[model samples]
Target: MTLPGLDLPALQPWFTAAVPGSGELRAELVHGGRSNLTYRLTDGTDTWVLRRPPLGALNPSAHDMGREYRVVAALAGTDVPVAPAVARCDDPAVLGVPFTVVGWVDGRVVRTADELDTLSAAEVQRCAFGLVEVLGRLHAVDPAAIGLADYGRAQGYLGRQIRRWNDQWARIATRDLPDIDTLHARLARTCPPEAGASIVHGDFRIDNTILDPADPGIVRALVDWEMATLGDPLADLGLHLAYADPAFDPVLGGKAAATSPRMPGREALARHYATATGRDPDALVEGLAFYVGLGYFKAAVIAEGIHARHVRGESVGRGYELVGGAVAPLAAAGIAALDGSG
Candidate 1:
């Protein structure tokens, strides 16, 4: 019998041909990130990471494996530590969908409070500051220098983000969420001008990156490029702060993967980013409400979508059952962020 989404018997030939001396392919799905399906593939001596859209229906732009490959490929020699891209397989006839493979990076993803506690206080501080520094470095990169000038429309990014998420809310909303509408209207009214364009990671935080297993403070590679695009850099910062909200823990079943108590405070993170980038912290703080509102709105919409899939019995996973309960809380958080209270 063939594996669920992969046909190893057929793929072994293609993989071996593309990557010489491969043998006895084996794959196990990597469970992290919300948008794309990822798997770790191994052939005894070597390992590779494969990424593709989740099985069944998917939002095309949200899971663009080719775009992920292209951006990561373009970042080959950049200061950003990314898993090196190996090859792209765009023919669905072979694997039922396009998939990208990258050299497997050896590292650990620290998420829980206990995990952070294990590291000395100094190490914990280092990991926390390291994350913000890396994010600042990413925002400082010039897209054209990396050949990603046309990655996405940089102008009017905030408006586009609002519209895009609002559309998603309409498609999968299971019930009425008045606060969602309230937050949307508020965010639209206060939408700030674009904060200059850069390569936005879409979802940036600690767990999204892999740390050196030995050193913990050093970042080996930044994974999960499903939502990567050229957009306002502040959007990434906002989302980073939003994810830090305790409300997000519900989506991950309480012990959220990136909530190590040792991590720097949200205010500290913003301050660090501002200092590193020479941006005015006061301006960033002033717009925090809008960005944070956008952040919570996006989270609520994504949770609703996952709940929609679960309702259809199309998605089965540990956190799927709990996602529906998260929307209301996130909506409240969004309003609070806008109110300068969250």
Candidate 2:
């Protein structure tokens, strides 16, 4: 009848208007995404995934359903498998927020290290290599070719990210950490030129993808495109490799795992990507550090923003406390990445 996040009576009309015969459906929140709120909708015969920004103040640039919908829709005939974009409702009057409806993909999203253990070691290894290959594939796609030429500026990606996240930290900070500032300055100073530009997934991780249940190696859909943009491909690579850091575990809790026990080392993943794309990984060493540091800082800022909302009684869910705890560890980890110690 009613869901806390999904206002059914309000949305039914929009669904009827956009999806035809989809006004009557059951909706449930799909948990685990730390940023956007995702819901699964089914009308007993058809299913769709709906995404909207979390309720509370949000960074407009970081959480945009239109961008997510557009990117996925553009990539429909692409090697990067994504849930088919079904409809988009820009009028907030229908659901109290802009939302995107996409075809629901039936698959498993392994979100933690323990979830990776359920499969055999070989399966886990397949999952790891498969993720790497898919990322390579995504980076190989051209923004201009896909009509995404204006997704973002092509050059100065690494410098802009370092400055952007540092600026974001200033906006939603709970407290000041010297290490974060140090990392920001160091990263800014050592920022390298863009090696090349492509449509970056912005946030690429094992959990961000849906694997075919029957074949764990197959990436059925790459979900969560809220951060997709045109930028240096290595920026995405650095962020991807940063998750292999054990420090990220605190953010996801110990359940719904994505980390792999048999994951190839970060260097190995980078090398494989370089070979696959013919982009030398050596040229990116310094920029990788910058991007990785920027990743940690961005994660910390996001956590801090969520924590700030929770503190202001504006958050929904049970895990805001744990998220706040991660801000410190992530900042410390960012320092390590910047200092070349981690």
Candidate 3:
């Protein structure tokens, strides 16, 4: 069977040459990912996961394979748990697009509330705190020590993020959303200074992580690094919180695991993160609303982008129809966050 975005016949020879002793390969698309296309590849004896850009990407940087490969490769020995980077193919002739292969992680991903339901209340709380601890640890890592000091420009990160997302809104918006513009203007005017720079996971949430099958409290691996960069760590926290909003439900086609009633609230997670990193609680409170608002802004743009791709028939998985409904609600939430009413 021919897989979309993967030419198995062309890939077999390259895989053999790249990783000796690997046998014939078979690929299966891993659903649920809305941006990049992920495939589970096995040669009967060995297994690996491949990630590449979507069928027709609107922004190359948003789905960069090389950037993802570089960050994951650099953080191999760090406290942050990540999949073993096996090989990277930058030559487009081989796969018709750049791609990266990592050893398949043996764990489970809880994306929707149905998946989270399998875990007990105690386990859910443990998992939530574990995720927060991991994020704190990630922000605490010294980028220079990890050879990622040049990963991104940390100065004026918030301003640049606003501009980037605003541009993205212009490109992917299906309709005029006045709240999005209002949110953008507010973020521009109230943009906070960098709350110290670190290696920020552009997207840090439960679904993006792989948890140990037997122990939900342990994170086996952190996948999806296409947006990893050095930036205000608070921005990462804000986005994480934004995903907890019920408004984000439609984007995932159902209730998100992050929004599970069993999980910790935004304040508890934020406090735990601050405690884990030895950050001042008062200081975090002072600037958190802006970051949360910014998170909503980013999420809205991303949802719109996915909807745009789906409308063009470029999206690879199910649930694309539900994503567009999230954009306006997310924008309204962002405005509320800034106004201190969310």
Candidate 4:
């Protein structure tokens, strides 16, 4: 079968040459990804995962294979659980776009409430705490020590993020959202000073991780590093909390495991992160609200981008139609978070 974004006949020789000992290849698109096009590839005996930018119009600085590969490659020996990076092809001549290949990891991805329900309540709580623990470990890793000191700018990260997402909004907005503009202005006005800088996973949540099937508390691998960068660690925490908002449900097709009522609330997760990272409780509680607001703004913009792609028939997934509905609610949530009502 011909895949939407892959040409198997053309890729066979390249994969064989790049990954020695690999035989003939077969590829299939992996669902649940709204941005990058992820493929599961195999040669009958060995398997690998390949990631590339989605087809059609591209967003500036988004869906970067090199960035994902570099960060995952550097994190191989760290405490962070990551799939083994195998090879990266930067020559667009090979696949019409840069792509990265990583060794396939065997684990379960609890993306929906139904999938999460298979685990016991205790397991669910453990899974939640496990995610928080892993995030703390990620924030503790020094960027410079991992040869990623230049991964992204740490200075003025909040301000730059505000500007960058605003630009992204302007480019992908299907409809004008005045609340988005208000949220942006509020974020700029209340942007907090960076407490410190570290390697922040642009997206950190249950669905983004591969959890051990037998033990949900064990995270096997942390995937999707396209947005990984050197930035305020709190931003990562904020985004994690933002994902827990019910407003995010539409983006994940209305049953996001992260938004499940069975899962721990945002306050619980935030407290766990603070305790795990040893941050001052009072300071984290205060600074975190702004980051949470920023997180919602970022998510809303991302949802709008996905909606735009769906409109242009560029998205390769089942739930793009529902993503557009998330933008307005998320923007309103951001405003509430900043106003101390969320």
Candidate 5:
């Protein structure tokens, strides 16, 4: 099917001109993601996935499509189940912004347990274990080997990130949400020690992956590299725990489905990651809190940004209202977790 909201006639010549072994590029929208634009492009005999920064995005460092391409390309021959990268176009003249193309991988991205209930228990375990193991491997990789040694600030990553998002909230603050600022201040004061620099998937949740049903737990392709970065590895683990934890507020935007209720939970996932990476989870709690709070704080800012975009007549839909509402509570939860209440 032809992709919606894309001008194929305008994009075709560019694809043919830059990428080889392609003819008659076709497009299709991949749904349910808000940060970046994703599309499946095919050329009758060849297929690829394209990702680019959102239209009119103000966060230049936040959405570096070229970095996504370079990082995924560097991991091409590794055991990580990343989609094979084809090419990247950094020139603004092509497709309005920088974009990268990777060969499409096949799998299902399950967001609810009903989807998993159909599968056998063993299969479910495989998917869960695979997710944990892959994360451990990701954390173990040396950034210098992949030409990403300078991906982020070499020191005080946590401190810099905390201040960055807090400033973002300050800039866009139109209402009196004391919780956001309170959390920021507390986290800044209790900033955890640097937990050794390594590659961290800023947002490492199950929804960002594609799982093969036949293999159940094994990820066929890990998607969404827009938030990938070089930072404290425990930060990635904490973000995973934040999303995997069973304590999220109920009624998640009328999705009305429990996606991770029985999937070994966050503690078990952490142990699995620890065992795989030979790291001690007990020693990483402080760092984890810092990262987890950062993750939630970042999520709130992103939701606010989306709300702002919606008010300006963007492509966002009403379903995002619930996402916007999650900001305050999630920020509060992060603070509590940092305060040793969670």
Candidate 6:
């Protein structure tokens, strides 16, 4: 039952030695994500997923697969809605780098806001509630149980974020954005003290979630644990706001128009999370600005890297043409807000 694409002769021994039916494994690429190379593997009747680093990226962390596996495995019995991790293969010879396989749950990715249009109002509300509740559960987990006691620094996390992304921009940026440096310095100067430490989803967004098609209210799995870290939980909330901010005119980037269907409005989502977590909404606003600035600054750095790659004839994808188009203005706005300008 080994799939046609995989090298059965080479993988047969390792597959057989690892799992009961590993010998019959077959795998096919699962398209949709840009970060990790994911594949769906099947052994006759049983199915699983394999995740690994992209083919030729200069990633600093060689153990991402192991890290993701460990994070998901540690939350196995918890309220977090994560796919079950089955096994991890760190031997580079097996797949050229570390990779992990997990049980493949059935669900559909919420890609665009139009997809939300098909759901009932109640389903939409439930999805919003479910997302917040799962995040709350993650933040509430005891990091000690997962051996992530040193996952991230609890104090001055915000200050560190401003500095880290600004430094990253200096390393990766190829073009001049008018105000990124000014904004970063100002944000750093005004950064408030650490609010509290909790597990933060560094890049939480609608596309990162898989929703049950039958019960749209339920989030079947929270994918992409690469950025999961120990930091201010409110930072995650702020990132969500930055992605879904309706105040920004969507006509310029079309991101807002595209997102209208997938995620709940920012106000509604904030209300839901606040009620569930018992956080005061008014008191969280100042922290929100810090996180928003951090989110946009980080995004701009990532986009600039992609744009630089494309400029150097190193990019392989189609959609990267829009990298600088969408990020530059947002980065400018972020800098403006930080500088106390309109």
Candidate 4 or 2, higher TM-score: 4
Mark the regions of model 4 whose C-alpha exceeds 4 Å error after superposition: none
lDDT tens digits by residue: candidate 5, 1-342: 334335678778788977766898778777666667788888889788888776554653678888888888887777777998888888776567788888888888776557667767777777777887988888778888877888777488888888888887766554668888888888789887777788877777766788886776778888888878888777777777776544332213334222356666656677778778887867554346666676667766766766555455554323545555666677787787776665
**Deviation in Å, model 5, residue 78 alpha carbon:** 1.7
lDDT of 6 at 227: 66
Q: lDDT at 214 for candidate 6?
A: 87
Question: Model 2: runs farther than 4 Å from truth?
Answer: 281-287
Q: Global lDDT for candidate 3?
A: 0.90
lDDT of 4 at 6: 83
Regions more than 4 Å wrong, model 5: 1-5, 245-259, 285-287, 316-318
lDDT of 4 by residue, 311-336 (tens): 99898879888889889999999999
lDDT of 1 by residue, 234-318 (tens): 8888888888776777565566646555577778888888988898987777777788789889889988887887787765335
Candidate 6 on 153-191: residue-level lDDT in tens? 777778777877777677767877767876777787878
- Overall local distance difference test of candidate 6: 0.68
User: Which lDDT value does model 1 have at 194?
Assistant: 88
Candidate 2 global CA lDDT score? 0.81
RMSD of 2: 1.7
Task: Indicate which candidate wins on lDDT.
Answer: 4
TM-score order of candidates, best first?
Answer: 4, 3, 1, 2, 5, 6
lDDT of 5: 0.72
Ranking by lDDT: 4, 3, 1, 2, 5, 6
Q: Give the clashing pairs for model 6.
A: 3-26, 113-261, 113-262
Which window of 10 residues has the lowest lDDT sum in candidate 2?
253-262
TM-scores of all predicted structures: 0.95, 0.95, 0.98, 0.98, 0.90, 0.85
For model 3, the stretches where C-alpha displacement exceeds 4 angstroms are none
